[model samples]
Target: MSEKTVIDLSRLRKPDYNGSVQELYFLEEHPEWMVCKTMPGGSVFDVGTIFSIPNSDICRTALRHKIYSLLETPEEWENIYGHICRKYARDKEFLAFLSEGPLEDFRLRGADTHHLGMIDRDTGEVYRKSFPPHPSQYVLVKKYKIIKPSRVSYNDNHLWDYSEYYGADKFVVPLENIVRIGLTSGSSIYRNYLNMNDAERKNYLKELGLREELVPWTLFAKPVVDFTTKYEPEDRSLKLQEALHVSGSSGKKLLDIIKMCILGAILVSEFFRKIGLFLWDLKWEIARDGDKLVFVDTIDTDSIRVTTKANYNNKDYFVNFNKQSMRDYYKIMHSQWFEATKSAKAAALKSGKSFLEHLRAGQAEGYYPGTPQVDRRFIDIQEDKFNTLIAYIYGQATLDSTIEKYNEIGLKEIGYYDANGVLEEYDKLNGMGEETVVRSQ
Candidate 1:
């Protein structure tokens, strides 16, 4: 079990002065230590004898001792304690206002808890400045007002609940469960995880076969962007082919690559249909866990750029746009495509041209043929299936509308709605694959 640590700022002592003083004096004198230690990268800053507190019981006890040793005067103690009391009083008032007003109306959905820090028992509120792993570092805090009475009351009442401030204390894991903690953010928590001692880290890696090297959690790490910006697509594609050749997987071929590309595009289309926003680009980080190729990293607004309309909108809206549902959709669709195309040599025999031709004929202008010829018939079938799935998820005729527009050019029965308010499956005609089935009036 990992050791636990506690840095009690309230018990700190003042420097130089010698008498019974309150803990607040020591904190006020070393406010920088209290505030800055929690800031991003602030842990590296050591003042005199104080090392930034580590998450361990021994370290916490030592820190507490050092703080007590610093405090020595009653006058200094009273001043600091008085100031702290006033600050707490102000915070309490704000908490009351929060409960009575906007907080009451605040609708929280899909809420997940993160451990900021411990709560002050007397004040009944967690100090925001001290909660983050690094208190001195600042990130932009998104602030908005609410107006629900119940939400306000809940917020106010919940302030007293320390459990609400500090989420589940223990990291509960079953004996045989494979728990992999991927570091995908540059947050302090990630840093702490990365800074674990060699032995501790080795134990963690043993469970998941994850390498110890630290990968930067930046959007720039995306393979697509890296390939497009640093090297020519043809050069990168050639490199990828070379890598595949060296791996000697007989099943992995140019056709498989093309299929993956098509599947990715289809997934993107579906994502746009549901979110009502078009993803400009996406970078997929795939890893094989046993027989499954799972996607890692977040797939949201931060990772990808999205536009509501074909053009940009100037209006500001509070929606996250980066919903988890969209991520799940991408994962599911990608997995399905991977399975479907595993043995698809026929699609590759046509040199990607067949798929392009079919896709072009089925859709009018503006839709680019993603791959060279393969099989237009299979391409049309995939497109229809993709459209149907999108309609089902989004409850909109995104596929139907596009198909209707393209029907004048030749594409027919792209998608249709069912009486159950779901996208209906297409009918297969002449074994050419299914076309969209529209609902009967």
Candidate 2:
């Protein structure tokens, strides 16, 4: 662990976008002086931020930029931005007409326009045909801007607010297995795959194999792939809508961003495949910079799910080298608590109360169980696995052992290479080969 910076409580203020795990703080003088505070020993069912890893944010941010660098295309960026400009123009036109037209007449026309899905919010439902930096890199604060102001320590141990200085808020857009080499077909393919019945899926796979001249059933059974946007539930979405001015077009834009995320996923998967790991599925945190979308936050094991070829088909959902493994353990082992939590949450929402308050009430009445204590062995194993994964991701691990493990698992027949080149590949794949130009100050 690194040395702690003594913070003065008077200088900091909380932001509206604080999450369950991470709290956002801004300097009273400079609101842009963003600090992300991750709670220590704060586990949701004993699986969360490992405080031992002090520079976790820096590493995760670097990793996100690496994945996004794969999508960078200087020539095409202008064309892409033009489309957003056009969409914004259309939105402005609608707003002007709404302001000028008679209230009764505009209301009648608005219903018809909405029914046909002509324009979504003020942004419109527009998508780019090619993959460009959908969410280009948006740097909130530079490394130099991050300060460890100290010497004035105040005792606030009751709430451990040790944090990394940076930005906040998030929106996740996930691309599943269905996104292949070309995302020309778009999210329709994802929707089709997700909605397929058992018989339909079998027939579709058979037809796909026949069309592509492939024979192996194993190919089709590899993993389910599709692109989807994760949105907060109604209450949460309403809060975001009110707070951030988020509209329907924001969600639509995220769906468009999925294509870029798909490309990044392919690049990342290829890199992971080199080291005896398979990128199962990962979610991306994106935000808007003016009219252009950009990748934000970190893409680490927490945002992704990983598994071996051997264990991918497991019904137990035993994810290898990912936080999902911890979540799966709790879901299976602590069913009573899990069920109680769901009930309490539902009851809380029903009565317009917070989940914690409802849970405490239930516990006092002896109707709900307390939070389960995770096994010590599980915690130890999770910590070790996370550390090992971090080492591998950072390219600090001895590739020889990972290569041997890869061969032992019979992945060599799939592809084999010299271990020495893995480091070289890591630097290139991670966008560390050249000096990174900071996009924002």
Candidate 3:
């Protein structure tokens, strides 16, 4: 919402015989003068000048007089030009002329490249008109069916628009809701863990049940040890010095090991609930925006790896073994999860039963619990179904089996910390390490 200035209408007059009534009226309504002229081959130039001038009395008087003359004079198209020019003079910066004539002429000439007409759902024909921008960009439009509406694709239709048109409520869930929980913490856990000082490194190893001497014997142990010693004092220069001491190969090896542990922590925290039916191995990107480490990428199925319950078990309970496969699998799994939830809801409503009851029935009938219902809205079921879904996806579920299952699927690391000294790590067992190198290069 920026301020706009009006152009004087009288300055637009050229040595034409008369003026146009329609043009005069347009200037009166839209004091912001726009240039509209025909081109050589029936083309039109409809351009708006980007200039502003103070709305003054002289310009107002000229506008009124020019408009009056255009109306009074019969076939007086010349008067319209006078009014338009006067309007244009009010705004000095209104310089550039966008040609509407070309667009209009292009349409009139039956240009095959012009697919500008909008289809009217009611008439099933093209509707030629101007469309304005909406306050919200998320609005979508869709058609209703006689019996059941067909599934809509996000790419093909606007979810918000369709929801509004169909009387379905649309809510703007903030992008923050999809953010990883650990990212809310200020420190980059992966980077901090990787850059741990000797004491911190020993502490970490102790957590993993490794003795002091045993730590150095592990693969990539030197870098981990160095990281511990470097970051222990929070001394920036010292940490860099220590990091520089390690060879690139050692850094890569240590980074891989750290990433695995961090991925384990994330998987343990977020994607545990969907463990049994679907594997969740997702690419995670984090950045230090201000003092916080924020996840900045799509956590959808496309960025993650997912597998069917059968396939996962058949493959010995593995998820994304590589970054590409991991992301691809997650995309499919996420889509499937969404579809399953929709189907389950539809089934429950159709049967006039609660989702949990329907799920219980399905379980009895030997159907896999595709998105289990944790609670009933009608009654205060202990487990909130929606909350359960959120918890499961974010790896906040209480079930140990769920946690173990996702871990078995192999979480791969994919991103690093930002410039604010936030530590980053990625899962390396699944070739995520290789994918990261390829993408970075």
Off by over 4 Å in 3: 1-269, 275-281, 308-441
Report the Cα lDDT for residue 32, model 1: 24
User: What's the lDDT of the predicted structure labeled candidate 1?
Assistant: 0.26
Index of the highest-lDDT prediction: 2
Candidate 1 structure quality by residue, lDDT tens digits, 1-119: 02332345445344322211111122333232221121100110010111111222122222222222212223333433344345446466533422332112212211111212233
lDDT of 2: 0.38
Give, for candidate 2, the lowest lDDT window spanning 10 residues: 111-120
Better of 2 and 3 by lDDT: 2
Question: Per-residue lDDT of 1-441 in model 2, one digit per residue for the tens?
Answer: 022223343344555345544455554544433444432232343223322323333334334444444334332333333433453364664334223322222123211000000111122221121111221111122111212212222452111121221132231222121333221111234335456787766665453332232221112222222333233221221122222222223444533444344434544676566666666566554443344444444455656655554221121111245554544444455667767766876675565445767777887898887667765545554555444544555566887766555333322211111132332222221111112111110
Candidate 3 structure quality by residue, lDDT tens digits, 251-325: 433333233223222332223332442322233332222222222222322233333221221232123221233
Q: Clashes in model 2: which pairs?
A: 135-293, 135-294, 176-225, 176-226, 177-225, 178-225, 178-226
Q: Which of 1 and 2 is the better model by lDDT? A: 2
RMSD of each: 27.8, 18.1, 29.8
Q: Arrange candidates by TM-score, descending.
A: 2, 1, 3
Span of ten consecutive residues with least summed lDDT in model 1: 39-48
